[model samples]
Target: MESVSRDLDMPDDSNPLRRLSLEQLRRRTSMKWRTYPHDVLPLWVAEMDVPLAEPVAEAITDAVALGDTGYPAGTAYAEALAEFAHKWWGWGGLAVGRTAIVPDVMLGIVEMLKLVSSPGDPVIVNCPVYPPFYQFVGNLDRPVVEAPLGPDLRIEFAALENAFRSAGRGSARGAALGAARGANRPVYLLCSPHNPTGTVHTAAELTRIAHLAREYGVRVVVDEIHAPIVAAGASFVPFLSVPGAENGLSLMSASKAWNLAGLKAALAIAGPEAADDLARIPEEVSHGPSHVGVIAHTAALRDGGDWLDALLRGLDDNRRLLASLLAEHLPSIGYAPAQGTFLAWLDCRDLGLGSDPAEAFLKRGRVALSSGRAFGTGGEGFVRLNLAASPEVITEAVRRMASAVV
Candidate 1:
């Protein structure tokens, strides 16, 4: 393990993320850095190469010094999240009482689904979505119905309504589900500031979705883990913030925005009308979060705004940097430019690299990016680029990607 500084000195430029070099990044054994060969530049995962924000690091270190690493406890983590939500998103009345701690965002989504649907019940999702949406919902024995994204990479309401209607009309799981319960209802899993593509659903769009979800008896569960990372000029709309959305559930965390994935903590926030359903989650599920993870996440919410602001500036620079890098190295590649998160969904179909373009880039150019096909339908001939690195790394990754095509 590369040692975390006991005392961090804010760098002269004050962008701690930009200070990391290729060699320094390689010294750590995190999955993102160590998964690929030494020669390969790995940008396939969501992990950021940034160092910990001082306040978060200090909180963890303080716990370590005091031997406070016991099983997770307390409402501090959830309360911290509520505070952050209120301050940044202007989300008032976020009752921490209606929230619960979970292992992470994905796991929380899994538990939330259980509250709304039964095994074999139809669950609706938008694709190309985060790949795990399929895996986790399927793991629960629920059938996932895809509502393909529109050509503009935004939600297609017509497609979504079709899926919801089919789900309401019932499917293979309908009879069994209906027989088990008096009536059968489905769950709609939404990804706000959606993964890979980085489209932040507008408040009006979300309100429409909420009305539709209520009309169709579909419970909505939004994965808002990327809520804190929207670009400077863009705005992120929290699902439950919209009118008529009080029955939906939202999952959020500091892990994604703060580069603390390995810490293992997240929150599942419930809308006012959804509190009863949230309370249905088994108490044992709360045990999954790491005690120290809560401490670190709390500190991030309470005291790491300056560091987060700095990292955001660095990431904004990298997003623009990735744009020019693509233009110079592979003008043929199609990119919409991400407005949220450090992810870029690039169109590689024109490159004629077949279904899995990342393979060629890895084998030929020694650059590793996430393959598009795995994200589901409409992802064919595309790649998800990570824009959470230094400008030089982003430049080099694209250069190598262009080289791979030749």
Candidate 2:
């Protein structure tokens, strides 16, 4: 990997693009005191410390200039999404007609939950998952069934099947009642290119999961926000694209990949039966999507490909650099560059961090990162690091970490 000094075309301090440096990001964002101090590097949050593409900026400016900030008409946004799906994922001219566009990823998940299940129902979640998955279920009074993970953080199929079968009659009853009452239950929240761990389930794995869901008569709500940012050699498999996954629902967004998270645009693609159910969700949700979000998302889909490509290259390089650094400085730590997502799950059990290195890195090294415990049971003794920043930022983070551990 090239050094930031050689590779990056440093922006002038006067330009917003130039202000994208770690120095400026610390000043502009409130992350300074909370995580990375003025001097320490930050590898914590999912947000990339990068500037918006010129096209994206232009679209937002153009929208505001025209005073067109009112709620967007659904047709154009839906078409833009359809085009992106076909162009990128080979989902072949799949039309997303009159879909309910929510404010953000979590909101979309909640909406899917609303469409499928009622309060106090059961939601199946894999352990060592993104923390929000647990909170989302708990907030709704939904009993969460813990699905243990394999050593690699991939789904333990046998355990998941057992959980689905014997998770309790309370769970089974809810599913059956939801099917009869026009509400769905026992929904499995599937994370594609899963967060924290960055494990991308293969098509075969997804097929097996779908078959199990089919046999158990449960619904699958897949969160695929990280699909667009996968490493170059990796291909993302959309759960709905797999055969026998006809009843599954897919959730995606430009937020994670394109750094449009604050703009709050996300999509929910449901199969035939699921789509019908989503369409019948209260009309109030029809307006949940912001006009600004739609505008930003449309612009990103229409003209953001070059920027996305560049980002993928930059992220891939950063991922490799960190992996290499870990291999050299912390030889005892074992990890591979994840096939998708900018987040890397560092196995720190060899370091003897005792289940929470995130705290040690912060208190001693002044480097802040998400604790593995935040992900769930199996996440202990590991740490999740975001490598979406400039190469210098990532390099500095590694340096700080090395100093503390050694």
**Top TM-score hit:** 1
User: Residue-wise lDDT of candidate 2 within 1-406, one digit each (tens)?
Assistant: 2244343457543222223655456555545334555555567878777778778899899989999898756666667767887788887634576356777778788888877777866788888888999988899888888898887678899888987775423444555664676653577888898887788899999999988887776778989999887888788888888888877777878888778877867877777656687786676665777788778888888888888887888777888888888877888777888888989888888886677988888777778888899888888888889887776667767777887785
Model 2's TM-score against the true structure: 0.91
| Candidate lDDT (C-alpha), each | 0.86, 0.77
**Which candidate number maximizes lDDT?**
1
Mark the regions of model 2 whose C-alpha exceeds 4 Å error after superposition.
1-19, 30-36, 168-178, 181-184
What are the clashing pairs of model 1? none
In order of listing, the candidates' clash counts read 0, 2
Off by over 4 Å in 1: 1-13, 169-181
Tens-digit per-residue lDDT, 1-406, candidate 1: 0112211222325775666666667898999988988888888899997888989989999999999999998889878877888888888767889999999999999999888778888889899999999999989999999999999888999999889888874443553565466576688999989998999889889999998776666789999999999888888889999998898999988998999999999999889999999999999998999999999999999999898888889888887888888888898889977788889999988888888999999999989999999899888899998888766677778878888997
The number of residue pairs in model 2 that clash at the backbone is 2
Error of 1 at 365 (Å): 0.6
